[model samples]
Target chain A: MTAISGWGRYPINDTEMIHPRTVDAARRATVQANPGIARGNGRAYGDAAVGVRQTIEMAHLNRMRAFDPRTGQLTVEAGLLLTDLIATFLPRGFFPYVVPGTSFITVGGAIAADVHGKNHHCQGGFGQYVENILLVLPTGETIGASREEHPDLFRATIGGMGLTGTILEATIRLRPIETGWIRQRTFVADDLDTTIGALECGDSATYSVAWIDCLARGARLGRSLIFLGEHAALHHLGERHVANRFPLRKPSMSMPVDAPSFVLNRWTAAAFNELYFRAGARKAASSTLVPTHPYFFPLDALGNWNRMYGRRGFVEHQSVLPIKNAQTTLAEMLDRIAKRGESAFLAVLKKLGAGSGSLSFPMPGYTLALDFPIERGLFSVLDELDELVVAAGGRLYLAKDARQSRATFEAGYSDLSFFSEVRRTVDPAGKLKSRLAERLLI
Target chain B: MAAAEKAVLILGGTSDIGRATALAFAQSQWTVRLAGRSLADLQREADDISVRTGRQVTAHPFDVLDTDSFTVFVNALPDLPDVVISVVGLLGEQPRAETDLDHAKEILRTNYEGPALILRVFAEQFLGRGYGSIVGVSSVAGDRGRGSNYFYGSAKAGFSAFLSGLRNRLAINSSIQVMTVKPGFVRTKMAEHRKLPPLITATPAEVGEAILGGLNRRRDVIYVRSIWFFVMLIIRLMPERIFKRLKL
Candidate 1:
């Protein structure tokens, strides 16, 4: 089975897990299906890749159907991975402008989620970078999308969570890189305010992110470390320069099994955070040699870091808020979590840049992603967070959502109805659906 | 929904918890702006917000790293918002990170550097505006780290601490509201799990509600679900050596 979701751990009927090696095969598989999903590399980490009765493995259909060098635009079967694009284009000085956190994902999957990258603050997401897309609607009809063609469907398809239809191919723009390495720097913020202050105090760059220590208590509750980067100047390439044009040695490992849940309690995590915090002494460094794939998506290399959550597998609660709610909102949230005693041991924060896409996830405010083992009463806490987000003038990412309610879905993404209306006009039958769509009532 | 037309802005517009929180505001009475990097993705989100809340909504482009422009974005807005939700993160790999320093660097940078800078500007703006709520999504991970994603966890640990400091600073200035949201397990795309057990897991909506409730009560550092209070209390008591050997 491909790695689409932690949910796929559930036993699937033998009829599921359909591997389709070609476009025709995928079509045939769908034509004679036990109800399935069009799966890519399964990097989505959600149930969207899995089907109720069957799952169509679309990796075999990967192929670069076409390319346009001058525009740095290319068309490929949806199954293609960012890795594939990087390999095919590095020689041509082009790359997928907006990538997710990893290179293991597929072109179709990226489109489905309208994935963003560190440069999202600059380039937006895959949706904006996409010049066009080829999709197989729920009605089994193949179609294309662009600014001018099926505009609503195009918008809906991006970050649509693979609910609109099966993405067949996408024409996307590429980015230019030098030696495939980033010029990076790091800064330590004594507190959340300083960290927030530093990010805005710096110059514009291609990428930026932050890590915070939440357990310090009192004065250091939201203290953090910030890092910023820009594409290395092309002229800076030295004799030591090298290009890691391919995935070296298939960097892969799997979680042999789930560990115990209580393994990551506060005391253990607090020590780890303290020990880990003082280790990063390097502020600014320039090296000709950096693995582009690993640098862009190191988590993918771990294969199963989720096992760190133990047998129950964990969930990520990520969200964004406007500048107005920056301090107090965060304070209230941390206090609430502390008061309740949930150990979301890992929380990372980042500032967003300005860019727009139909189905994108980054924004101008701060964003936080935290991992937590599933437990009781968690939902109510999330519900409180939902209220705060509402009052604060923010929205959540649908592609990353799983347990959100229909009311919340409607509240956060009120504009989806227009997309939904258009979707209804396209496939009136509601053939394209997933657990997310069901739960959110989208 | 009303002539006052309160609006909520989610800076980390792509996070599940952020989205769910936004939905909660929509349900009440507020125009929702699904602010983020991709306007298209946020457009659908805006649409959803309006439908749920029966309020007008729109998607706007924003850049937290560019605080100079943040005010411009706000001034450019048709109306200023009453609340803000910030949920962001980056979990870098710990193993490869030890060998590939860049991986480790990205993990720390993504979690701390970016968010810290922008929130400063947000606070100043809030002071000038004299009325607003800021919900920063921090994690219990920052409370500490395990062998896994330690760099990422430490960054969050730092953020969690920072939020507390910010709250204390804002307390004297009653005009501003700060809420730190720390949730344990939330079922979302980032985690990708089904049947998250009852003891620790939560949905984005649940976290959303808790955050709002905390905001209304003017509380600080809200746990998405209350059970995490007990769970962490126990986890914090475990001995270090024993905790290290723990396979969890």
Candidate 2:
């Protein structure tokens, strides 16, 4: 058995990690391992991809099956990382329709999580672009699923946390871009109300997100810099970027190991947030031409950035509130964190469109994400936050969730029964299992 | 697929190092041909690389131990590649290898005879062409045989010596280059069972980068991570009395 953990590096488990390079090998592994979960790149922040008994590491199975340049549709193995896809296709004028904050995740992980991006307000989640998926059932039977066929299974599989089956491959439609640049504009919001207003006003933008100061209180509560971006066409580029139409980013620095536990304290987080907010505020005056990589995935430049949270690791609390009372709920959420003085160094807010899939996290609402270093009393505070979120008809993102009560999950997702039904249909004996599945009683 | 001006062939193409090196070359716009015992695995790897780089990548079946088929394989290629890399190796269980003649022979032949024989054919072809590069992925274990893995170590030692001899002979032809890469403790399947120190362990991509850099600079011998060179040097310098007393 090997010790493994997701990106958070917390709650590590001892499991046999099997790396099968071919579909046949993977099917054979599933037959041998009675209950296991398929893990892709291990980018999920929690135990969603971890199987205590056996974890099928899909890294070796990555391959491209087919592609149609004319339609920008590509069929790729589930293990293919979004990072590789972007590097390969951005230069060729095509890009994934929905890319999460980090491109390090795998296609399978994205589909399983139904991940949303900065463009959620316009493009929805990644699952919307997937035309079809090939899934290997626990019985080792490979079946094709799409909206037109096996619609229930298809809906259950997306954002199902790998409970239904092992994703073999998927055919996804890619968006075409003229250049690898974003015409970015920033809006500075002074308080919680203004931040919500700015986000609502920027809904027309192709991509939009906000960096809020969770520590800010009173007059500065929820102070944020809203960044709105649109894919820059060739004509929009300046002379300097014209020659190099598509440029892939290389991480300039890396955190080789976890920082000392004392490195990330309340004071340090506040100070960093202060400096970050001020720096972003300075750029609020005029629009800028930024590389798409930095605009979309700024933190990816710092390789292994999760290590910055120190040895105890960190937990991301991402909750989406219904559009009706989202602003008030967000205000209360920020106030709670600010009052505790355990404000996160990285807090993001985005507007989500109507969601698809039975267990998809997004809705026609606002989602707030905050990363807090794991510490004593942290769980109690998060539980309190969850209460407030649930009261406002909100739910937490499963991709980023490390801990949440089963009741909280059910209360948030009303379609849980439908998802469970389809999951049982595909894996009757519950042959496919994960830590997340066990914790959520899915 | 656009026809690349240059082409490179990779032996043992399904191996971690071979796959990584193939990706590095493909990204640099070289048409890639991957040869291994399993055409299925090679075809999958080739397709992946081709998609990632939009370069033509073809898969061919070539058994390293089947010396008689080497000539036929070369003759069957549509075009001769400008560069060739051999990454064949076997890390059979050291304890079993020590006690079993068949196991020991398999390791020796895989690490030494098979790679040497196949590379020899490619070397002769390069010589005839008067311009080609040959890369042999050897191991740091070759520097000094340890009690824990002497069987694989000795085979690598012989392979490294063979590469040195080939480099010496190829020097007469200025255009032909021969490079030997010693990757110490790579995080590939070969070392997956061991607890490799993160500080010293190199990823397959690192080894790939080192090989590409060495090939570009025409370096005759290279350690994937420079620290490995000094580490191996210290090991090679140890007195036999002390080395025998200490277990590696």
Candidate 3:
């Protein structure tokens, strides 16, 4: 048994990890092992992909099955990483329709989490682009799920958190692109109201997100810098890149070791936030052409960056609030966080459109994601925040949740009954299980 | 005149390193042919690489143990490949190999004799063509045999020596290049059971790039991690009186 943890590095578990190379081997292992869960790259940030009995690592099962260039349809194994897909096709003028904060995630994890990207306000979640899935049921029976076939099961499995079955492969639609560049327009919002207004104003953009300063209080509370972007057309390319529009470069900076917990205290966080806001404001002079990497995934430039949060690790509380009164609710939540005096190092706010899938996290609202180091009394503070979210008829994103109570989850996801019914139909005995499922009593 | 497309044939194509190397070569605009025991698995890999790189890829069945079929396999190819790589290896349980003669023989044959024999066949073909590159994937464990896994280590040692002799023989004409790749603790299926040091263990893709780089430079022998060269040299030069006492 090897000790493993999610990307957060907290809540470690000793699991019998199985690595299978082929689809047949994966099915056989699932059939023979005890209750288990399928893990892809371990990018979930929480225990949603870990199981005590077994955690089948699916990295080796990655392979491209087919591709139709005319229609931009690609079939790939579940273990294929989004990074590899982009490396192969980005130069060919194709890209995944939806990508989350990091492209290091696997296709299977994206589907299981129903992940959304900066463009979520317009394009929806990753599950919306998935055309079909080949799933290995708990009983080891392989079945196909798509919109026309097993539609209910399909919806449930999309964001079911891997409870329905182990995903073997998926067929997804890729969007055509002219270049690997984003034409970015930055806006600096003075406070919470302006931030919300800026996001609402940028809804027509293909992609939009904001970096908020949680430590700012009083007049500057919820002050943020919003970035809105659209894919750059061929004509937008400068002279240097016109000949080779899809230049890709790997990240070179990496955190070599776990930093001391004191490195992320309030003084450092406040100072960092101040400098960051100023730099962003200064850079907001005019529209700029940025590479896809920095425009969409700036944090990825630093590898193993989570190590900077310290060995105790950090937890991210991400919840989506309905449009109605979301501003007031966000103000109240930010007020509580500011009063607590604990630093939230990375806080993001994005607009979300209505999403498909029974357990999908979006609901045509605004989602605020806050990262706080695990320290004394932080859980209670997060508990209070959960209550505020629940009261506002919003739900927490399961992909980022590690400590929310079962009651809180049930209160948020009202479509649990449909998910449970599909679970019964596929895995009656609950042969497929995970730490997240156990904690949430799914 | 249009230049003919360069081609590479990879034996043991199902292995991680082989698959990765094939991808690297294909991405560089070379035709790739994958040969292994399972045509189905090889065909799937070929198709995947073909689609990803938009290069020509084909699969054929070849077994290292079946030496008699080597000639037939080479003859059946549509065209002679410019480069051939052998990446077959087996890491049997040390305890089982120590006690069971069948397991011991299987380990030795799989790691040493089989790869050597297959490469010899390809070397002959390359000599007839007057130009070619041959790469053999060996291991650092062969540098100095350890008490814990001498059976596997010794086989790799023999394979390494065989590659050296082949390189020496091919240099007589100075046209064929024989390269031996000694990777240390790669993070592949063969080493998954052991908890390798993250600092030293290389991903298969790293090994693939190293192999391609070594071939491009015409390096006779290359270590995936440069640190392994010093580590192995120290172990090889260690006094037997002191080395035999400690566990590796």
Judged by TM-score, which candidate is best? 3
lDDT of 3 by residue, A1-442 (tens): 9888888887788889988889988898778657889999998888988985999889987799899999999999999999889988999999999989888889999999999999999999999999999999978899899999989989998987888899999999999999998899888999999999999989899999999999999999999999999999999998987866987856559999999999998889999999999999998848998888777777788989889999998889999999996999999999999989888998999999987899999998999999988899999999999999999999999988889999899999999999999999999888788889889989
Model 1: how far is A424 from its true place, Å?
0.4
Candidate 1, A1-442: lDDT as tens digits: 3434533232122325776645656666655544455767765544556665567777755656555556776777788777766765665566677777778778888887777776665556777888898877666678898889988788788777776777877888876655566666777777777777776665376676767776756677677666666655556555555433332425578778776877877667777777756764344332333456666776777776667777655566677767678667776666667666677677777666542444455567777766666666776787787777767766666655555567766666646767687667765766555556655666
Native-to-model Cα distance after best TM-score fit, residue A212 in candidate 3, in Å: 2.3
Judged by whole-model lDDT over C-alpha atoms, candidate 2 comes out at 0.89
Top lDDT model: 3
lDDT of 3 by residue, B1-248 (tens): 11128999999998889999999888888899999999999988998998899888999999888888888998998888888999998888899997899999999998998899988988888888789899999999899899999999999999999999999987884689999999898988787678999888898888889988998899999999999999899999999999999798
Better of 1 and 3 by TM-score: 3
User: Candidates 2 and 3: which is better by TM-score?
Assistant: 3
lDDT of 1: 0.68
Chain B TM-scores, listed for every candidate in order, come to: 0.87, 0.96, 0.96
Please give the distance, in angstroms, between residue A194's alpha carbon in candidate 1 and its true position after superposition: 1.6
Task: Give the interface RMSD values of the models in order.
Answer: 16.5, 1.3, 0.8
Model 1, which residues run further than 4 Å from truth? A1-15, A28-36, A242-250, A281-289, A353-359, B1-248
